[model samples]
Target chain A: MVDVSQASGAEGPAISMRSRLSPYALPIFLIALIAVSGIVSPAFLSTSNISNMLLQVAPLGIVVIGQAFVIILRGLDLSVSSVMATAAVIATGFSGQNSDVLSILLIAVGIGIATGLVNGWLVTKRSVSPFLATLATMIVLQGFRFAYTQGAPSGNVPPLFRLIGSATWHGVPYNMMLLVVLAIVFGVVLAKSRFGREVYITGGSPTTARLLGINADRVTIIGYVISGALAAIAGLVLSGYVGIVDNWVGRGFELDSIVAAVMGGISLSGGQGGILGGLFGAAILVVVFNAVLLFGLPVQLQIIIKGMVIVLAAAFYVRRRI
Target chain B: MTALAPIRLSSRLRANQGVLVVAALLVILLIFGAFISDRFRTTSNILNIFEQSTGLALVSLGQTLAILTGGIDLSVGSMISLLSTLTSGLIAGKVSMVLPVAIGILLLGLLIGICNGLLIIWLRVHPLIVTLGMSAVLQGIVLLYSLGPAGSVPPSFNFLAYGKVLGLPIGAVFILVLFLLVALFLRYARLGRYIYAVGDDEVGARLMGLPRARVMLTVYGFSGFCCGLTAIYLTSRFSVGQPYTGLNYTLASITPVVVGGTLLSGGKGGVFGTLLGVYLVSLINNVLNFMDVSTHYQLIAQGLIVIAAVSIYVEKKKRV
Candidate 1:
């Protein structure tokens, strides 16, 4: 519907430039940001600092993998942050010695999957928009958390959680290693699997996908399920890193995951970007957040910067697509 | 062709079903509320419900316009938070500054909306992202400006919310007048119809040579203005501005719009239905408060209503 004022002859360079730089843009930008930060605060890139950053980023990266799948399927999951928080709270609530780690893990993932199922069912079967469905779920979950916690949450992040989340091997945090392994596995799942291609097709063109016998609804639901499961895992990782359970835990990671996925080249409108890009986006965010903390800036700056990142990334990725 | 009249009648019933449902539910709630609680059916209590609903009603009107045009404004809550803070901070309890501060904050709200619209157009990004980002920016600004209850309004300024006109709260009166005006505009005005047309079918509206950019700008700008108005009322009610004052309005505003029968997909909803939705939600909350029974199951009742309402409409659309 837009009027193209320029002639075809004049529009060639911009198109070529986008193709050449878009994929590598986040990494290049990450490096540039690192170099600036390293110069400004030489301690920012120190070995210990890097490991700390990795530990902090693992939770976000884990969630980003899930978020990328949902975005790739042309859906948004607002309930992810809620899921993350709920999982953490429930995991920590079992303060008794009788509770095993495996049971807690199962319960956390079960919460995520159940939420994903509800979200998926709403979007796919009941015909609710993904945004609204997830938003409603988020609200319900928030209310649930409030009712359960009554504004004051009790319980500690288990020692096992803290150990898995913060412990390192040869200066590499365990959570970071988990994130890397999960990313590779899911990345391969997304790029090479039949389900992965189906997700892309459904997002890119539901009609075409339907014609090709892809169960679009089933695929979309699975995407939500994956998002839910990963977000739950992310929640535990976050609680471990923080070493506590509180109402505020995992509150804003939904936006961060969206920003990360979108920044990493996962298209907001769907059917684009990849797992590696999401990881890179998470890297960029962690570095930015680390730098902000390093500067002793107010946390409010992080909120403002996050908004700017979403807008800028949307501009970079979405503007050219049309 | 021969059966057109009956089909048209049925379709019209179906079309207006959301408002009818919400209206019926509102009536049912009033009845249930009155039956259960001694204080429920009094005129003052009922009027109080309407007064309390003014913020939601005002904000939802703007949300209705946005959703009606196949978009959303997630920044309304944050804008309210920012504007309310700016209002009290700028006025600083000076009665003389209230006029200027009010005008400035209202304009700022409109400016925020226009910025959201412009960014959407410029970046060719979805409204969700633009407004979500704007929401964060506004939230951050408000936090930086004030972490807690920041400033106070003069006693005289409280009239916006607390003043009574013919036994009705002034704020509710404003809602009546504004809702009626917006409803009329939607029914008769060109831009109003264009809003529906745009939301109903963007491609068709573009092909019809409608000013798509201008339409989006006006829709968002009005939404922002409504938020500004709501913030003012909120500030008047509370007598002080706090950073978190408007945070809940973002979701609260959307609920009324959808519950009143507006489609999230845009194009088929109205201000009156949204108004009814607002009243219904307020009454539900009031009744819940009266009962004092917390439904862990009940906690989700609101979200469930939104989901259920949206599902009904969306399912109907799919079948058609």
Candidate 2:
């Protein structure tokens, strides 16, 4: 008997109620899980357990921020892992004492921007669909990484850079803080700025925004560039942590980011979501992954579970999509 | 009027596709081949190109179908991996090659196709997410089955991949059969028209009473079936089943599908064009190999070509 529109309007309160309560759900679940683990072993919530959890979440969280931006524009960047791998290798290659670390970082970021330029150029100017174009970029970049690395990664990070991965400042890891700062910056950009409004407008209705002369192409390009740059930053973080460069350094990162975005209540169709949603989603994913390890699951089984979570996230979004 | 004329002209710049770019690249490649190497023009080399393209050709054909429906299949590569893994392991375990291969491959295809369809339809998930999840699931299953590297296909199986009849590779025959079947279905069948109709405008198709879900389900299912067939030859040709073998095809398959004149937005291209696209990509790979260019450079070039092809398509579509 409830009209659909009326029902949707009513959904606001319901969703807010759900949102307010949902944060506690995961934490509660984690605590319960910890209690169970404690029952099994007194060391379940030990320092190493928490550090390991943070370590796994840090790299994925950095990439997910980039993923969040692109998804907000109703686009995808499938090349994040490849970008990470390529950037990581590039970063590692410049690890010598005499090597210009700053220049290498710039060059690595430049590589990402270049990739983004191609990706954005095709999508905006060439009219390639975001899905296919990004996917192609991903493959090519992956291949490029493999070719450049010659399937063997020998470069090591300089000690200073390695500290970013292994060292913590004021009892917090630099990478984790990097993620927190990015979350705030992204939060403001999407929620406060003129560019952010343009993003929402462009995503909601590109043609309508065009009629208003919002420069849809430019906005889109900026969004993708941000994604690419952030992904490169993610590579930098990963390089600092992993110590050694490998060809597959960022493998399957695109999926992880997408999953995080969806979990954060950012609709895949675009123009809906906040930084909080994205961050929360990333937290949830990391927690679940930690849950898997804490629960003693095998690696292959973990992969399968992650895949299931992705599908379930999509399914959840579809059900709640307005 | 003159100043306005350019604006009008610019709007017309977006053509439906820039297939001509690929055609030009094809010509350039041929010219390069002629200039660089004599073996390029030989019958055997050309035959070898056709033979080499079989797996990709099949996958591209499936990609074309998926793209036509305004969707994609990330699961195809995973499907290939699973089929290759299962086929090799089963064969190695002394399972009869003939019946087991046929039934096992078909059943997996159906299962995968149905799983994809059901998830997409009933759960209302995007094709990308569903297939991506399916890809991981398939990878898990394949890994579970093989547990590691599986045995190579019996040499006799390779005959389908390596054999020739009257100076033609059997792969050429398989390609021909697949093309004809696809061509016939798309050209003369009710389902075929329905596919194009749905691709053009799903809402319009629905208004016209097309079975949109059915068509989508069928196309995806058929894509999975083709993966099975492709896997049969893959095991034969490679002589081994690799858990990671099919990952590269995810992108390589799309190059041909996009190059074949299909719109990634869906409902605008067909298998014949995909066949041509496949041939073009196949030829490029072979020519690159013949020229002795390092594979790394070849990959970079291939990536550039993909961007160029899609960019051209986008430009052409805007013109139209």
Candidate 3:
């Protein structure tokens, strides 16, 4: 409604314009990193290298899109990484080397819906904090994965998955194409739809949203379900790319998604930013990771650097807001 | 007068509800354990539970402090990992080096905690993000320090875990002493009450002239100190310096605090409650072991218990 827009207008056009420019920082930084990478390694900008980087970023970007939606509702999906892992295990374990891709996909989606519903129920119906509820879901799901696998998950990802995960069409990775389509669809929905507007209103203030007749609980639950489903899709794609599944399949993704979302200008407090910003953030992260690999640094050093970058990015954004 | 009496009784129950719930859960678990296994009632088994609970108890003490101030420290697990790796690498079976190594590890913990506190307060970053980032950094540092499981602690260091003092394991005795000291401090100290006040309502506490930033710093720093202590125990118990030794410790530590009936939202929990929580979890694990149930079931149970416990507390608060 115009009420929300009118309320935001009181902040003045200058502030709004500044916020508009703020989202570009991540993409600019990504470009600078890419330039630096090319200088460090002449082959870094090669088509093969670039395509590989895109492939790496695709799954994360998809997951961050989902994370963005949840953050917009002032909630965090800490269970995302675990959900991804579960999906990967389920997809492979269910297919059982026979490559029953359709059933595997169905089961993965079903798991996502079920986990999301549980999270939503705990948070909404039971009145548990989102952080704790998602955290509990993460732990339980992780345990379920271990129990199902009994410490070792067996089975290979089907060829159909491999095609979507790793295959390219005319020099463009299928994964990247999928990401672009998803990004556009989500971006349009978030930017133009009434549901998206309701999400923003809820994130800004649940009480205010409820007073305006928005079903804040329903919006919040839907946001979580979308996040869970996307995370599962990303996991499925990752499984296909790796062609194997393991306990540590999606390790660090939860943190990485948060970092990327935040870096992309998605406010941690919620009700700000967009899908494009999250995509840029994911791209920047993948680029930095690619650069680190090219520099011949140890994996430990890469993690240390990534951690420092997250802290620094957060600090920078906080300072800018002030 | 009759209505007043009922109201008073309900109010009294509400005031002590967290403690009562935890106590009831502990009793139920004990009864369940005794009914299920002969080993559960044995003196040695009970002592073993206490011994196993010592590390978690210490970590939960720190977590209780942090949560009391309405913040969290996800880096505690990583802090334990770093401390243990450093201590074992430095001590390397040298009894003479224990004091200095221990001091060094604790100091690092203090430094890490201070950094977290300062960043959260000065930079105005959320404690969750800062601590999560710090956890990653600490993990990376641990991995860098030791690529694999390396370093052996001295036989004397093992005494911390294996030693018996006055018919009790030394670790359990230490835990009890620390718990009592913290309980007394929370009951009597100015800063302790300030932590509760701040967590309950930060702005109100600020307006009341409480040193808000200082309280936050001290809680986080103390939490780090606890992690250092936990690291010492873990290293002693495991006898190895592994990079990933305390991978689940952060969540494990938090679970007991919440299960002990501390509101994750903060301001209403104590070290004693956390101790009860630690024991409850340790007892559950012990019972599961005795019952020959898979460890995964324990994980599922723990997750469910935290959700259930927090839900009950929320429901009760709503009623009140």
Candidate 4:
């Protein structure tokens, strides 16, 4: 996407260098973290450990991709966690031993689309603030899950899910491969598609985008629907990984995705950054967690470090922008 | 003259619509509650509702201030958890340690507030993300301090929650007094006006040469202080320092603020509306309890209520 002429035309080499450097920063940081972890404990560099970490972070990476889209539209889906839980609950609760897994997946996707439509209608039609609207949806969905499951979810995730969730091929995790393929597809769509350009324009300025004849409202709704569907996919994967369903499933995924997206340099203000940034951000967070584990620190310390990283990255970005 | 009078009256009514809506809702709910259950109107039950609302009232007050300045403080809940644990740990059932513990907690609150304000002002980050990060940090700190509930509160502290003053619950009285003080400050203080101005239009307020950073800092600091006060009350009521006591306070506090008719985008609404909002929520919970409805329904109801309230309020504002 970088054109040498455009880089040299207006902003000069300094701005171009910064722009070029920013996208690669997360991957470099991930490598550095991996090196540090390997130095701390050589076992961290083992193939098994690396594969395991990839499997664990794959779901988060998927969710982060979805979050990146919504955030690019200058909106947020605080309901993602609840949406994930609802999807998992629906998938398992409806699917019996003889039930078809494909139909269950379809049902999950339907629920995601319905929830996204509700969120979109509230934001686009009713003019509600995205934060409050999504939060309200989150709370309502949580209650719905509780009422539906009656405090405990039943039925087991299908074996197909298990295969996808935990199986590997030639030393690479299937889930990780799924994440990589999805990431590439989304990255291409964001970089080379008209819809992606419209998203950037709409987020940059709704009025301007509308003036340019872009269907801002339609775009926003579609963005939310995509986010919902992706979140449900993540939920499906997570349910398979855990092998059971509960109301608390995907409890913190929303915040985790947001953190990863922000750390990847996706502007919260929207209209900038890409899915690749989100993937890199998710990878960095996973590596950090792996490093923390290798260090044998308490889980609480991991939380503390994660919080510090968010604040520090935000501060750094703010300073750089200024 | 007659034409001007109607116009003025309509404008005044529009200005007070939030309080009016919440007050009307409260009255209707109260009447419905009384009709549904004989115990709903009992003196003890009414007092209990008021007492239970005190913590939320304090937290909402802080939230209102932050929101008025076009910001939010998600960390208030976590601050409550941390302050409660820290104060209760220090108290350990000793009345002599209350003063020092309380001061320490308040100072810590102020320090957190300062950090939040400086980061937002200097680094210029979105308040939502900043506060979210702060909440996570505070959660970690609380976890580090105590894995679970710990420490016993002094009896003197208990009086703040359970004591009676002039035949009314002390907690209710405290909330009323605090409400009046905040109302007066918002009505009369220069800083309060500046807050509204900044929230209404940051560029305009800056052009007017208002001390934007200081106003933001004071707003956050005041919010932190409210959290500290809430921590004390919660600790007393529970009789122990619970690490997760304030887990729901963040959302709960926001509910009242939004339901009270305060614009989420800021620059409108008042603490008076918040008072009515708090009572409205408390009454709803009380009624649900009386009707034997599960708490799960209440959660759903709260969510619907927030969405409905914000939608109606924003639509009204737009029309005006």
Highest lDDT against the true fold, candidate: 1
lDDT tens digits, residue span B1-320, model 1: 86799999899998898788888888888889989999887888888898899888989999999999888899998999999988888889998999999999889989988998899778888898899999999899999999988878899998998899887798888899999999999999999999999888888888889998999999999999998999998999899889899988888899999898888777888988898889888898889878886755455888888888878777433210
Summarize candidate 1's per-residue lDDT along A1-322 as a digit string, tens digits: 1111222124367665775676778778999999999999999989989888888889999999999999988888899999999988887788623346788899989989999999999998988878889999998987888788887788777788888888998888989889989999999898888888888878766777888898999999999999999999999888888877887689999899999998888887677778899889999999998999887899899999999999988888763542
In model 2, chain B matches the true chain B with a TM-score of 0.89
Q: Measured by C-alpha RMSD in angstroms, how accurate is candidate 2?
A: 5.3
Tens digits of per-residue lDDT for model 4, A10-126: 544555566678867877888888888898899999999988887888889988988888888888888889888888887787655535688878988888888888888888888
Worst lDDT 10-window in candidate 4 chain A: A1-10
Badly placed stretches (over 4 Å) of model 4 are: A1-17, A95-98, A319-322, B1-5, B315-320
Q: Compare the candidates by TM-score and give the number of the best one.
A: 3
Instruction: Give the true-contact fraction for every prediction, in order.
Output: 0.71, 0.60, 0.61, 0.59
Instruction: List candidate 1 segments past 4 Å from native.
Output: A1-17, A96-99, A319-322, B1-7, B294-299, B315-320
Point out the higher-scoring one by lDDT: 1 or 4: 1
**Which of candidates 1 and 2 is the stronger one according to DockQ?**
1
**C-alpha RMSD for every candidate:** 4.1, 5.3, 2.6, 2.7
lDDT of 4 by residue, B1-320 (tens): 98799899999999888788888888899899889989888999999999999999999998998888778888888889988988788898888888888888888888888888887887788777788888888888899899988778767788888999899999899899999999899889999889898877777888899999998898888888899889988988888887788988988999898888777777888888888889999989999899998878889998998888877876432210
Task: Write model 2 residue lDDT over B1-320, tens digit each, in one string.
Answer: 88899887665443423455567777888888878888898888889889999999888888788878878888988889888877777787354665677688877886787779788887878788888889888887787666666876666777879899888998888798879898899999999989889878877888888898898889888888888888877888887787877877877888887787788777887887788788898888888899887887777777777887777665333211
lDDT minimum window of 10 residues, candidate 3 chain A: A313-322
Looking at candidate 2 chain B, the ten consecutive residues that score lowest on lDDT are B311-320
Per-prediction DockQ:
0.55, 0.43, 0.53, 0.54
Question: Candidate 2 chain A vs. true chain A: TM-score?
Answer: 0.87
The C-alpha stretches of model 2 lying farther than 4 A from their native spots are A1-44, A319-322, B1-28, B93-95, B315-320
For candidate 3, report its TM-score.
0.96
TM-scores for chain A over all candidates:
0.92, 0.87, 0.93, 0.92
